[model samples]
Target: MRKIYNSYINNFTGLSKEIWLLSLVTFVNRAGAMVIPFLSLYLVNDRCFSMPDVGWIMTSYGLGSLTGTWIGGRLTDKIGFYKVITLSLFFGGLGFIGLQWLDSFAGFCIGIFTLILIADAYRPAIYVASDVYSKPENKTRSIALIRLAINLGFSIGPLIGGMIIASIDYSSLFWIDGISCVIASIGLFVLLKPKEKDKIDPDSSIKKEGLPPLLNKLYILLFIIMVLTSITFVQYFSVMPLYWAKEHFLSEDLIGWLMFVNGAIIVIFEMPLVGYLERINISKTMATFWGGVFIALSFIVINITSWSGVLIIGMLLLTLGEMIGSPFSSALALEMAPKGRKGSYMGLFSMSFSISHIFGHNGGMNLADTYGFDTTWWIMVGVLIIVSILTIWLYKLLKKSPTFEGT
Candidate 1:
């Protein structure tokens, strides 16, 4: 037992204090992530919004996320990540406070859009901080640590949120979430020191020495694959809850517990899983391919069976995929970026997932509402297969590059 405990500690030994604190901040922020997970339910049940209305509002949030990440990257490069992260957290908390007052459709739309724009901007800044704080060999582990913190908090959030909604009201959710964000912002501000901003001017032409991230063909292919995978993966939040509640006849508490299970699995396994993947010399592309495949299988299993016991099996598969894919994808983005452009690369990568939210939530909801849940699941399976193929192609293409030797 001592040997195993020591080995576990050894696995996480090399990361910096900044990374640890950043992980803590991530935990605090995500622990309050009750809003997004329950947003669709709130809109449909509480606000009495139509499915289309829900889709549009979610799309608006996605658009805000897309815009926020892009602009945040530029700001992080120009002004420094410290300012960007702190400001994003502080103001994002205020946005949530504002959201509690808005009751109409337009007000809700505008409120959600503004809130996401400020809140999601923190993503790239955090990624940049993760990269800046850790050594190259520990990069993947560092990213995993951050994700572990996020999932740990996520596990807590929805469970507590379930109780909150059950006993209190949605207004309490916003207040709690908002307060959490502000506290996280204060923690970050007190802990993280200011660093020199990236020197490259955003408006200037790309130096002849290296291609800009936007023009890099390999990176673009990776981004496309991310979009495809996220489209399928996002259904867990967007439609799965609705399906469980409406179709499976699960209660709100039960649905929250299911979501908690997803997070709990990731928190338990993600770090060791990344360590094992790295030790085995698994390529990021291959990990991603298998992850995509597992995600598809998760939904396929759901399509084939309705047993509640089987649902845990499916959720396990989905969580396993997330454990494999998410951190390595971030590591790959950092590995591929030019010096001084990590923020931009991370931003663009963040945007890929954000962009998918637009299509995933809107498209998935539309299909489920119109065609049925099974149709949506089948479509997800088809999309994941294509994404897996693309990942394979990406792997082969990377094998030819000079950097490929190290990757």
Candidate 2:
């Protein structure tokens, strides 16, 4: 027991204090993220929006997210990550606060788009910041810490959010979400001043570079795989709640507890898992391929049984897949980035996920509304199988790459 405890502590030892602070900021911001987990429920139950309308609204959210990441990446390169983060937090907070007043379909479309645009700009900046803040050796662990913070906060938010909705109302969720961002903004602004390296880059660096690394064929294929895999994984958030409610007649809090199970499992296991994988010198892409297999199996588990206990089984498998894949996949992207263009590369990396948001949520919801949740689950299994195959191909191709040959 003592040996295991010390090993776990050692995994956390080398990261910079700034990374910890940055992760704390992430936790605070995400801790109040009550609105998203239950957003579909709110739309269906409270606003009475049809599933098709919800899909369109989610599409707008994706567009906004896509645009936000692009702009944020450029802004991070030009003005610095600090300023970009500030803009995201402050404007995102105001947007969340403003969202409650918009109940009409058009209003929601515009509001969700604008709100996500502002909030998601934080994505690329934070990714770049995570890379910059840590020692090269500690980079993966640092990113894991940020993810842990996000997951830990996500775990708390849904559990508490379900209770809050039961007691107060969905509108209260918006207020708390908005207020938390505001508080996060204040904390970030007051405490975190990044080093001078974060400032505007020398334009000559881009000139010295030939084609951008993000435009590489290897990079593009990797991005596509991320999109497909993310699309499959994202349904858990977008449509899984509907599945639980409509199929099993679960209450709001029960759904929250289930979501909590996913997040908590990730938080508890991810860092140590990442550390162990790093020490073992495993192939990152191969790890991603295996993780995709688990993600696919998660969907398959639903069709195997109607027992509600299967939700736990699927969640556990999904969480394991996430743990196995996420950090190594991140290391791949970051490793591919050229020194001066980390923001641009990370921006492109982050964009893969944002693009999925547009397709994933809308497509999953549409499928659920059309064919029923079982079909949606089966379809996801098919999609993830493709993702897994592509990941394996990428892994093989990377083994031949001049850069990866040595590593």
Candidate 3:
């Protein structure tokens, strides 16, 4: 056991103090966030709100995220990452606590807006900090490790929330979630003190090459690729279960476990696979991985009639694709960023998912409802193919672009 542990520790090179701290912060932040998937349920079972009403309130949260992501990205560049992360935790905690007093739909909406806005605001801060703290060689692994922490928290948080909800009232879910956020906030507050003063001035550090004149350049192209892929990504949570429940005849609990399986696989396999994948070029690997994902995702479209076997196989492929795509996306974003604005680059990357959620959820639901789950699944697969092609093309464009040089 000791030998295995030592070997594992030895494999980690260039693991910085800041990365470790950021990972811990991510873990804590995600633990609090896991409560959100259950928020709709709490509104229905506890708050006496209708499903449609709860959905509108949830929409407010998405709006908050849209605004918060942009605001957070700017704030990370201006104020500093540590402060933004601190506020994220503080607001997240406050939002959870506010749920205690929530009675009407409007009250719930207000609380959700506050929680989502603040909670989302901190994300870009964390991403920028992680990117800044990292060197190029280990950047992919570092980001993967950070994601692993978030996934770890995701793995455990839901289980704990389920236990709490089963044993206690829905109110306890919010109370515990609030406390977790507070504790997470305190951890970040104490540990992640800014070292900006120790570093060179931002302007002196790396002079900014003012905005790239054309918005239709490589960076923008990459953003579009991500958005396309995210159509399938967001479906994992939003409509997949609904489709499974209605058509595949899967139980909600089973769907949850499948998601749990996805998370668990990522946490287990992500780090070990990092080195092997790093040996390949980022663009090629991304294309290949996403291609594989699309092919596997195609399996989901076939009507297997049995939910268990087919769902598991398709979801497993989806998870594998996710494991490949996520870290690669982060690394690619960092590579594409201009100097002194890693935060802004990462912030835009983060928005891909947020935007997808807003559209993908509503869109996928509408497609599934109007057409069928198979049609929706096939459409997403087609989108994934577009994403892969665009990613490869963008990689070529980025290689040729003059802006590749960091000013």
Candidate 4:
């Protein structure tokens, strides 16, 4: 028993104090982000917006996210990550709470767009921060550790947010979310003292000949895969809440627990699994392929049975895929980037997710609102199959390079 405990804890070693501290800050920041997981619920239940209107508001969210990542990524490279993260968190938090005042469809569309643009800037900036803090040998594990904090935050947030909704009102979610973000911003200011300048080797750090990610054919294909994969994944937070309530008849708190379960599994197992995969020298893309396949199966499993226990089973498979797939996808993006262009690479990569939010939220809601829940799950399964096929193409395309297998 003691040996097992030591081995489990050992998986998390070899990271810098900054990554851990950043992880703490990320935890608080994302916990406040609980407001997002419940955004559909608020619009549908409290605000009484129709499905199409909610879809438009969410579409604005994706547009904002796309622009924000573009700006944040560029700014992190120019001004520095500390400034980007600090400013994004502080202002974005205020914007989230300020959203309580908006009512009309156009107002929500514009408001969510602006707020998400500011909020999502924090995404790619944190990716760059992870790169700056980690050593090459343990980079994937380092990212997994940061996600460890994020998943832990996600786990706690939904459970509490559920209880709050059950007892009080949705407005309370906005207040707590905003306050926690402000606290996280203050923590960032105190804990992560910035360097004189971002340290990079001058020789390697000079801009490479190809500054454009679109110019690289392999990368463009990879971007397509990421965008598709994210569309299927985005449905989890966007439409699943409605699916659970309207279809399965779950209460607010139960739906929260289900989401909490997804985060909990990732928090407990992702780091150790990443460590084990690295030690065994598995191909990163190969792991990602399996991850996509597992997630695809997760959606299929939902349609397999009417039992509530099926949700638990499906959640486990989904978590397994997420743990295996997400870090490697991130590490692969980092690996492909030239030394000086890490910010730009991550920005484009993060934009893939933003694009997914645009398609995923609006599309999933439209289908659910029109057809029913089962059709949406089946369609998501089909989309994920395309992601899996793209991953295979990327895997084969990289074989000519010596580092293809490792990357």
> Each prediction's TM-score against the native?
0.96, 0.96, 0.87, 0.97
Q: Between the candidate structures 1 and 4, which one is better when assessed by TM-score?
A: 4
- lDDT winner between candidates 2 and 3: 2
Q: Residue 212 in candidate 1 has what lDDT?
A: 71
- What does candidate 2's lDDT look like per residue over 95-174, in tens digits? 99999999789889998988998999899899888877777889889988999999999999999999998888999999
Q: Looking at candidate 3, what is the lDDT of residue 278?
A: 71
Candidate 4 TM-score, true structure as reference: 0.97
Q: For candidate 1, write residues 1-407 as lDDT tens digits.
A: 99977766776889999899999988998899887788888899899998878888888888889889988888877676778888998899888877878779888878887888898889888888888788889999999999999999999999888888888888888988888899999999888766533322322224433567789999999999999999888888778888888878877778789889989988877887898889999898788888888899899998897776777888999998889889888898888888667778889999998898888899998999899999999999999989988998899899889876445
The residue pairs that clash in candidate 3, if any, are none
Better of 1 and 3 by lDDT: 1
Q: Sort every candidate by TM-score, greatest first.
A: 4, 2, 1, 3
**What digit string (tens of lDDT, one per residue) describes model 3 on residues 341-394?**
666776787777667666665677677667877777778877776776776666
In the predicted model 4, the residue pairs found to clash are: none
Cα lDDT over the full model 4: 0.87
- Highest-scoring model, lDDT: 4
On the 0 to 100 scale, the lDDT of residue 209 in model 2 is: 47
Point out where model 4 deviates above 4 Å.
198-205, 209-211, 403-405
